[model samples]
Target: MNSLLITSTEESTGKTAIALALATLASAQGASVGYMKPKGTRLQSNVGKILDEDPMLARDLLDSTDDLAEMEPVIYSPTFIENAIRGQEDPDALRDRVAENFAHLATDRDLMVVEGGGSYTTGGIIGLTDADVANVLDSKVLLVATYREPGDVDDVLAAAESFGDRLGGVLFNAVKDADYDRVSTDVVPFLESRGIPVYGVLPRKRELAGLTVSALAKELGAQLVTPNVPTDGYIERFVVGAMGAEAALSQFRRTKAAAMITGGDRTDIQTAALEAPGITCLLLTGGFQPPGAVVGKAAERGVPILLMQTDTMTTIERAEDVIRSGRTRDEETVASMRELLAAHADVDAILQ
Candidate 1:
């Protein structure tokens, strides 16, 4: 079976998202697509069984028949490193297990998409880095780079150099509107000149990147104050209301589908956010509940109000964590991602 190793320069570059899109496209073209994450770092406990979240998500997205344990194979829990240091886990044996599981999973498949854990250096502790795994599996590398700034090109090039001819290409994702032209003209050509293929340069779509209100509430461990709001509705941007109500309103107005983060006592700011356009939800920090009138207004507007005990900074940090690790599971986000990839990415080149 032909295998493609999907990895990234850093974490949260949408490695799984790109993998799912590619697998979807490949399946549409009649290829039997299989996916596996050799070493799972985002350890999850599914009813006492340890598994990785990415493989679970991929299994559902691809409608694969493989069991979760088979799909992930190697899970690194909080105690894994400690056990390894104490000689409880054998690195060579682990490698063999990963290889065995991969071979079994790839059986009868036309193409297998192997997702690397986190960055290229992620699994070095267990000797299963992205390049190492790719070499072991005899698969080509397709690096997914999240366009943060001009310096990202250098990072991608360095990765390409590390992969050498094993690197199939780079997919530039989450390119902001301001940097689209530069990425298409300068970044793409520079990478190609260095012998790296540019398969796709995808623009940033807030709908695909944002976290839903339900996800935010779960992450913040907050109590929902407003009832019956659409938990699946997403917030594209975050507006922290630390300033005066008037100033905060201006900042909130600039963002579409924003989750307004403010102190619970800031009734002025909370009211202003409710009045603003594209206000998906209100995250009230400091454990203080908004006035009854404010809650009534939010309830009337069908907005979800999450009340948290944490301070503003801590809440913002947690929200960032949620957004960074959030996946495109909802139908709308999945469809949007597939459409974006189909339009921008060279599916024919990717499949081959």
Candidate 2:
């Protein structure tokens, strides 16, 4: 069976998001697509609740429940590489386990999209780094490098130079709107001249950023209070509370949003928000347990309250963190992803 691995040069660069985008494009072309996240981390709080595992996200977006292990078996932790190197664990066993999972996924699927953990330069002690998985699966690598500053292009080129033939192409993500023309005109030529295909230069559009509210809650290693929150349409804008109750309430009041995000423990803020007019959705951050009163009020008002365990600061940080990384429907770069899937024509071909 053939599989393609999507990876990045660093964390939070939208690896899983890009994988899903590719799946969206492939499914459009009639490919029976399968997805896998070889290393699952940042697990959910509830027992047996798997979260931030790339395979699960891939399967959910693809609308299928393939076996979790087969889709991805070797989950990674901070000490994974350390333990493996000390001979406390077996890398080959982990490899075999994931391979078995892959075999199952490959049986019924025409194309399987495998996502990597962290940057391509990353490797855990248990023997599953981006390179290890790439070598084992014999899959071509599509590197996602986010452009945050002037030297970002050099990093991508260096990664390509480092990986050499294993590198299939690179996609420049999270690019500023002003630099789009410059990147396409100036940067694209240099990269192409060096024989590295600038697959596409994606503008720093918010909509194309990865994971909506519900998805963020899942990834934050928190409990999911509202499973199916509306994330498909346009999110008007986001407002975060930095000061205490007065500041939060005042800021929240200014927003006429489809959704409002705040700390779960901020009862004063929550109470005010519950009583306030014109908010359809409430996102409680830092996993704060909502007061009974707030919960009851929200229910009566028919407002959806998402209780995520990430702390107020961390939650807001995470939200704002990925805001620039979110995906949208209006960008030309998205069109490029669609185009690549169409050009490939076969999942098996890319996998091979």
Candidate 3:
């Protein structure tokens, strides 16, 4: 069974999303493909029953399973890593475990996609990171480069050099039309001269992010507040704690606005937000029993309430990743990202 590890030099570089897209495209081409997020922080569980966090999305996009635990492992807290290293737990041990799982999954499959952690050089001291794990699995890497500027090229080259002979190729992702022109015109030529193979430069589209949100809402059975809201007007800045609500609200008022996600139990916060005009929707973080009064207040005021089982911190982190990496424009976004990965991923080359 042959496999390739998809990694990036930083978080929100479209690593998981790109891997899923690749799997989907490859599958459409009639290649038997399977995907897995080797190491992750959050696990999807519901009312004593475990659920695949993004099961439907995974299946719909990549045509994979939600029942497979190895598909995504929850490894969020710092304590988890500490324990894994001290042998109190084997959190990072996912490298080989996922490898075996992929080898098994690849029995009749054409290609196995192993998605990496935050970045290739991300393992903490005293433990193996994604790069080390890739080495252990002896899999070549497919880098997801997400960038918006010229520095992106340097970063991608950096990662490529760090991975050395393990570099399979590069995927310039989330690019805009203009950026793609600059890259394939100037940047790509330079890299090619240095012996790098730019596998594919994918364009940036709102469809990708929209697909994630829509799938999440369907999986959680959460309702959309404003279905007609333009993707461009969607809220980009997210505030987690109530302490920042005032600023968040003020910012939303300036923009066309989309949704305001909060906690169902946060009546005080909800009421305060209700009093404010110019807001679109409200998302309650925790899955708690909503009181009739709160529901009445929200409905009467025409505010949409989205309820998510995940806590505030987890929700915030997830939302941030989606927003930061969710720019929906054109080809330049992809080219810029690829260039960035090429620069920063050169850990070994830089050290030398």
Error of 2 at 333 (Å): 14
For model 1, the stretches where C-alpha displacement exceeds 4 angstroms are 85-88, 218-221, 228-233, 237-257, 262-280, 296-303, 309-317, 328-332
* Residue 93, candidate 1: C-alpha displacement in angstroms: 1.9
- For residue 73, model 3's alpha carbon misses the true position, in angstroms, by 6.1
Sort the candidates on lDDT, descending order.
1, 2, 3
**lDDT of all predictions, in order shown?**
0.84, 0.66, 0.60
Measured against the true structure, the TM-scores of the candidates, in listed sequence, are 0.86, 0.63, 0.62
Q: How far does residue 181 in candidate 3 sit from its true spot (Å)?
A: 2.6
Best by lDDT: 1
Candidate 2 local lDDT, 121-143, one digit each (tens): 66556667777887777777888
User: In terms of lDDT, which candidate is stronger, 1 or 3?
Assistant: 1
What local lDDT score does residue 159 receive in model 2, on the 0 to 100 scale? 75
Clashes of 2: 20
